[model samples]
Target: MAKVLVLYYSAFGHIETLANAVAEGARGAGAEVDVKRVPEPPRPAHHAQAGQSAPVAEIGDLASYDAIIVGTGTRFGRMSGPMASFLDQGGGLWAKGALNGKVGAAFTSTGTQHGGQETTLFSIITNLLHFGMVIVGLDYGFQGQMTTSEIVGGAPYGATTIAGGDGSRQPSAIELDGARYQGRRVAEVAQKLHG
Candidate 1:
């Protein structure tokens, strides 16, 4: 069976919820999904200096997986520091081309309609490119849109979530579909490549 890793970091549980939806999509598409959270770094003292990176979970070998799907919440229109730090830890793998030729994609949650959802997705994808992974995005032609309308999570770029301004809204139907679609697409590509 093909394996797809759904790795992410969540500060307020929104991104974590989105990650589960992404895994659901991957599972629906017939792939074994491994969902892992990036561990947070120790919080600095209240009086400590700013601009500190958070703690993250140690990732094991990616060589065993067929693909990887990274997730994060938008922070200043980019992926969160925890998620970025997690990617940084993959340098050794990147140096050796361990992720080369594998399928890859990204997803994100925004606190508002214009909270840089696409940009966060792009930021993660940019890192994936350096790892030599084949990037995949949701196609505009997917048929599961009516279940949830007016939301843009189902992008040709990747899965996404608006999450509303107050960050109280749950994942919309369209966003859920988008996540699943991307997961399934990733699995399909991986199967084809490794078949």
Candidate 2:
């Protein structure tokens, strides 16, 4: 079976919610998903590791998966710092062509409609590109966008969730569908590429 790595760094829980939806979508598409959280390092009483990036909540070996779906919260029109840092640490993998030709997708959560959800998704996608991964995006043809109960998900770029002003908005039915569709698409593409 093909494995999809659903990696994320969620702060206010909205990103985490989106990650679960993405996983569900992958499962529905007949893919095995390994959900991994980037591990955050413990805050030191004193300033330790002056040049280190922010602590990750979890981490995993990306080479183990056939595809990777990264999710994060939008921060001022960009991916969160933690996610960026994690991507930066993937240089070793890129140098060795570890993730080459793998299917890649991105998703994000934002506070408002124009809160940089698309930008965050692109930022994540850019990092994946450096690893020679093929990017996957959401298409309007999917019925989920038009039939969803709320306007919480879907983008020309990829799957996303509008988490609302207070960050408590649940993902709409359409958004969930979009996520799953994207997941299935990635799985299908990976299978073809691998075969």
Candidate 3:
């Protein structure tokens, strides 16, 4: 079976929830899945990351997976600081092309609908592309992203969720479905490429 990793940095648990959903879908698609979190940088005494129980990921772990799905919330219309810091530590991996030919995908959350979710996905995707990984996105086949009757967050770029200004909003059903679809697609692609 292919191995898949769901690596994430979630400040308020939204991305973490989506990460689990991604893992579930990957597992269902017949890949062995691991869910891991990026180490958090030192912050002020306030605002601890609550309930983030996944084992912290090591940079070398990225090479072991047939596919890697990255998750993080957007910060100031970009990828979060800690995830950026974690990924930046992998120059040696990039130099050696450790991630080359692996399937890579991205998922994210934002505080507002216009908070640059697609941009954050691109930020993660750019790193994967530099590592020479094959990029997979939440393509239009999901169809959940096209609805207009309610607020939702899925894009042709990747799956996403709106966390609200205060972070109270949880991912809706459609958002979680998009995440699952993306994960399964990544795993299926990985299986085809690496099997």
Candidate 4:
């Protein structure tokens, strides 16, 4: 079976929810999955408010996974600092080309409809490409991107969710569905490549 890792950084749990959806999808595709969160700076108040904890990702040996799905919150049209920091630590892996041939995908959550979700996803994708991984994305075929009646967040780049200006709005069902599709598609691609 393919091994897939869903790595993410979530401050208020929005991306965490989306990451779980992605892991579920990958599992459904018959892959063994690990859903982990990149270590973030201490946020005592935020953690208290969130009232939950996530499995912290250990930085090492990324080459073992057949696929990697990265998710993060947007920061001025870029990835969150913690996620960026975690990825920056992958320089050793990059030098060794340890992640080459792995399937790579990205996801994000923004505080507003135009809050740099695509840019954040692309930033993560750029790093994946640097590792020589094959990119996977949520395409128009998902149908979630075609919805016009309500605001949603899925694009050819990846899946995303709008968390609202105050970080109150949660991901809509369609958004989660889009995330699931991306995860499952990535797992499928990884399985084929592994074969």
Best-performing candidate as measured by TM-score: 3
The residue ranges of model 3 lying beyond 4 angstroms of the native Cα positions read 44-46
RMSD of 2: 5.5
Off by over 4 Å in 1: 44-57, 143-149
Q: Where in model 2 is the C-alpha error above 4 Å?
A: 41-60, 146-150
Q: If scored against the real structure, what TM-score would every candidate get?
A: 0.86, 0.85, 0.97, 0.95
TM-score of 1: 0.86
Question: Global lDDT of each model?
Answer: 0.77, 0.77, 0.92, 0.89
* Residues 54-172, model 3: lDDT tens digits: 99999999989999999999988889999999999989999998999999999999989999999999999999999999999999999999999999999998899999988889999
Worst 10 residues of 4 by lDDT: 43-52
Winner of 1 and 4 under lDDT: 4
Which lDDT tens digits does candidate 2 get at residues 74-176?
8899987777877788877888899999989998888898899888888998998989999988877676755545466678678888888776687776777
Clashing pairs in 1: 25-180, 39-57, 40-55, 41-54, 41-55
RMSD values, in order shown: 4.8, 5.5, 1.1, 1.6
Show where candidate 4 strays beyond 4 Å: 42-53
For model 4 the TM-score comes to 0.95
Ranking the candidates on lDDT from highest down gives 3, 4, 1, 2
Please state the error at residue 133 of candidate 4 in Å. 0.7
**What's the alpha carbon RMSD for model 4?**
1.6
> Which residue pairs in candidate 3 collide?
none
The candidate that wins on lDDT is 3
In candidate 2, residue 110 scores what lDDT?
A: 86
What is candidate 1's lDDT per residue for 67-150, written digit by digit as tens?
A: 998888888899988788778889888888889999899988887878887899899999999999999887765665333546
